[model samples]
Target: MADWGAIGAVKSAVNIPVIANGDIIDAPSASRALELSGADGVMIGRGAQGQPWVLAQIAAELAGQVYRGPQGHALADVILKHYEDVIRFYGPDLGVRNARKHLTWYLERLEGGMELRNLIIRERDASVVLKRLTEGLKNCGPIIEVAA
Candidate 1:
């Protein structure tokens, strides 16, 4: 969790808009951070690692708008699209290496994904990685495991 007290102090001192960061993962946490820090907004780092739509989801929740996160095939499509974009921007060689971290993050919460994660992270070929990712996403069910 963020030191919202310190953030509040900063907010009290500054004239510009304050954006609270750290541990603001979900909508509830984001709301709490804003309330505790008295900030205009919150910034998320690790929280938005693989699930990039999280910030927008938080925003919608804050605004009392209907927000639905991607699931199933939709979520798979998003992950694949992100992968392809990274490859396009960085080229296959660097992109595969760079995207491993993001792919790992994406698979962190998935069920039956450990094997896929291992394969995806180790494989250098973008096409092979993509195929594995698609298959993994399709096969793996939603089963988030809490880290100890």
Candidate 2:
């Protein structure tokens, strides 16, 4: 954050909210980021991936409130949505090609994800990729488990 001192200073001097980006990927970091930037708020990017609740958590914490997302399927659903969005945004060939990155990103959060990530990277067919992803989701076990 200190590395962005000049940008922060300019924004502060101008009385405009100078949102700092990069590096900060979690709530704790977001708080420290606010202190470091001396700005009005923090901007979350990759940190919010697979965790849409991150924004809410940061906002809640900043407001002096306790924040926690519902445990089961919360992370998985978001990752799935991200994958769908990628496919939707990019189309099959390009989407699947582009999906490699997001797929890797999604799988990285899963246990034993590296192996799956490697497989995804090697795959060339879009349908195969989606199939493997569905299978991976099933075999990888519940991202969120509800205790009976």
Candidate 2 structure lDDT: 0.68
For candidate 1, the TM-score is 0.89
Q: Which candidate is the best by TM-score?
A: 1
What ranges in model 2 sit over 4 Å off?
A: 1-7, 49-52, 69-72, 141-148
Off by over 4 Å in 1: 143-145
- For model 2, the run of ten residues with the poorest summed lDDT: 139-148
Give TM per candidate.
0.89, 0.76
For model 1, what is the C-alpha lDDT against the true structure? 0.85
Q: What are the lDDT scores of the predictions, listed in order? A: 0.85, 0.68
In model 1, the clashing pairs are none
